[model samples]
Target: MEHKIQPLLNYISKYIVLSKKDEAVLMSKLIYRKYLKGQYIAQQGDVCKYECFVISGCTKMFFADEEGQEHIVMFSIEDWWTADMGSFITQTPADYNVQCIENTELVLFSYDVIEELYTEIPQLERFFRKIIEKAFVASQKRIVRSFSLSAKDRYLYFRNQYPKIEQRIPQYMIASYLGITKEFLSKIKGQLIIDQ
Candidate 1:
């Protein structure tokens, strides 16, 4: 578990170098968590306490409507961060639920600890600001894709963006993420195969 922290440390160091003492201070706040497949990391209406960095396995952030249909918002795998951003930052109920898609290992940092770390390590604040900026850019791209792309084009783009996800995630979940019916997704896949 200790060795697993190195890669994350390296990632943070790229944005700002941390002294050994600061590193130790930062490390002390992180805790390892394990979740089984199908477990909820944060459920709808729950306040998210921790923001998780995936060490291994995958998670999906989704919302279930009144009809019980799930709409996938995002997926996180190795080296990625996953959390209900609205809930985590604002300390409010989450509209979406984050669930593990596989046996997952994560390093979690609580909101309070993160704020204190930013105070103590000014560079960490800059690091997170840059991270948030990148996240916003990605979100903008997703919005553009949803508005401008056909379902088939969207599927193709999603495949290109996360090639490994097809093997890790369920077809129905992918269909949800693409904002299409499962049957339509199946037809799209069939057409793709025939075209190939």
Candidate 2:
């Protein structure tokens, strides 16, 4: 059981020094969960209380408009974290829904438990802050791509940034993330195939 947590501890260790005892304590508060494909891990209007780290498979965060069309915010793969930052930090309802795109495994740490851990293991505070900085950079990049790049350029950028995502997610979902219609994406893909 503790061994199952080593990967998560190893992930944190890159940013902070966790003593054996601290690792044990931190692992004790972590909860492992599995979700089948198409399962909702968190929904719009629900408060996101858990900060989840993906262990395997893929998940996406999206929000629906008044027409009920989903616009994908981002995708989370193995070793990546997923949460509605606004909801998680503010303890308010989320504007996005997070769902598994495939059978997924994740480790969830509650906000309260993480706060306690930060207090007990001060080094974790800096570690988590770095995580926030990475999230900010990603968000900034997404915004810049959306505003300054064409859909094809954005698609290519996304593919370059997450080289493995094309193999993992459905084309329709990727199209949604790129803010382009499925047909357009198909055309782009066809062109790529020709170029290759």
Candidate 3:
């Protein structure tokens, strides 16, 4: 478990240095879990109690519309942090669901544990603030791209950003994430191959 948590510690250390005591406290608070593919780590309408750091494998955060069409919001891979931010922060029901794309290992921290960490380790607060800022920036970029870019451009950008993801997950999920139909994504992929 300690070995699996090194990636998370390294990630935090990139933003803020942790003293030995802070590190121990943070480690103590984490709960490790393994999830199989197709399992949900969080479900819509449930209060999201924990924020998870991926130790391995992949997951997708998505929401189903009234018509029951799933819209992928984001994908998380190894070393990535994932949670429904509003739900976790406000202790409200999540609007999105997080499900594994492959068998996954994660280290989770409850909302209360996070708050305690913030108080116990000031540097951790700074680290999390930076993490949220980055998430916000990424969200803004995705929004801008959706409005400004064509489907092909969006797919291309996504491919560049997460080069390994396409091989791991089904194409339809990628299409959903890009807000395009699977047929359109297939056409785009075909065009790319033809061009090559």
* lDDT against the true structure, each candidate: 0.90, 0.89, 0.92
- Misplaced by over 4 Å in model 3 are none
**1 or 2, greater by lDDT:** 1
Model 3, 1-196: lDDT tens per residue?
6687899988887888888888888889899999999999899999998899999989999999999999999999998988888899999999999999999999998999989988988778888889999999999999999999999999999999999788899999999999999999999999999999
TM-score for each prediction? Answer: 0.96, 0.96, 0.97
Candidates arranged by lDDT, highest first: 3, 1, 2
True-structure RMSD, every candidate: 1.1, 1.1, 0.9
Judged by whole-model lDDT over C-alpha atoms, candidate 3 comes out at: 0.92
Model 2, 132: alpha-carbon shift in Å? 0.8
Model 2 over residues 15-126: C-alpha lDDT tens digits? Answer: 8888988887887778988899999888999999888989888999999999999999899998899999899989999999999999998999888988998888888889
At residue 192, give the lDDT of candidate 2. Answer: 88
Cα lDDT tens digits, model 1, 68-159, are 88999999998788999889999999999999999998889899989998888788889888887888899899999999999999999999
**lDDT accuracy of residue 32 in candidate 1:** 84
The C-alpha stretches of model 1 lying farther than 4 A from their native spots are none
Candidate with top lDDT is 3
